[model samples]
Target: TEMFESDNVDLKKQMQTYNGLDHPFSIGDELLVENSQFLLKMKTDMPNVVVFTFNDTSSWKSDMNIYKAHSGFTLEAQNLPNDINLLGKDAPSILQKDQAFYSRTTYQIIEKLL
Candidate 1:
């Protein structure tokens, strides 16, 4: 997550500098932010999971955009909760170089009749 935050800050700073020079920001170098907290909570037993992330745009406020990305899966009931604190500690180390850890698990889903 630190990697994402640092990248976001750097991108915003670059955009600010560009704006100051009367230049337009390009989408090619845009940063994609993720909801690390919500992502870390998804379990394998759940039918689906939704993660929400916010963008860093203090540098430029004319445009505030929110994007939603989704994925579908079925849980097998053997998944467990992850230790988010430990993951946060490792964020710095992971961000130093351009890399990320991808984990997977199954969640139990309950059906509700309306």
Candidate 2:
């Protein structure tokens, strides 16, 4: 399986920053979601979604290459329950250059909240 959360320090830092700015964002309450451009892992203990702002994540390129590779990808988020060890793979993520966002392309967030 393709793994997005590699226990990398930089990615961890980005996740921390995403949980900043005096705000709380959750899809269904207390669900911590570690996400890439096309993959997401959700946990109940942590309530956050790591947003990836790239058309493609270099990290999962190899994992994805294993498959035939279709035209588009899915916004996948598998639930990793309490104390459950898991990591992996999204939804439409909006990002503004003003804020700290992990991105590879040149794009801007039109509206602050969507």
Best by TM-score: 2
Q: Rate the local accuracy (lDDT) of all candidates.
A: 0.33, 0.35
Please give the TM-score that candidate 2 achieves against the real structure.
0.18
| Cα TM-score per model | 0.16, 0.18
The clash count for each model shown is: 7, 3
Tens-place lDDT per residue, model 2, 6-45, is: 4666545544554212222345532332334332334333
Q: In model 1, where is the ten-residue run with the lowest total lDDT?
A: 71-80
Q: How close is each model in CA RMSD to the real structure? A: 16.4, 16.9
Top-lDDT candidate index:
2
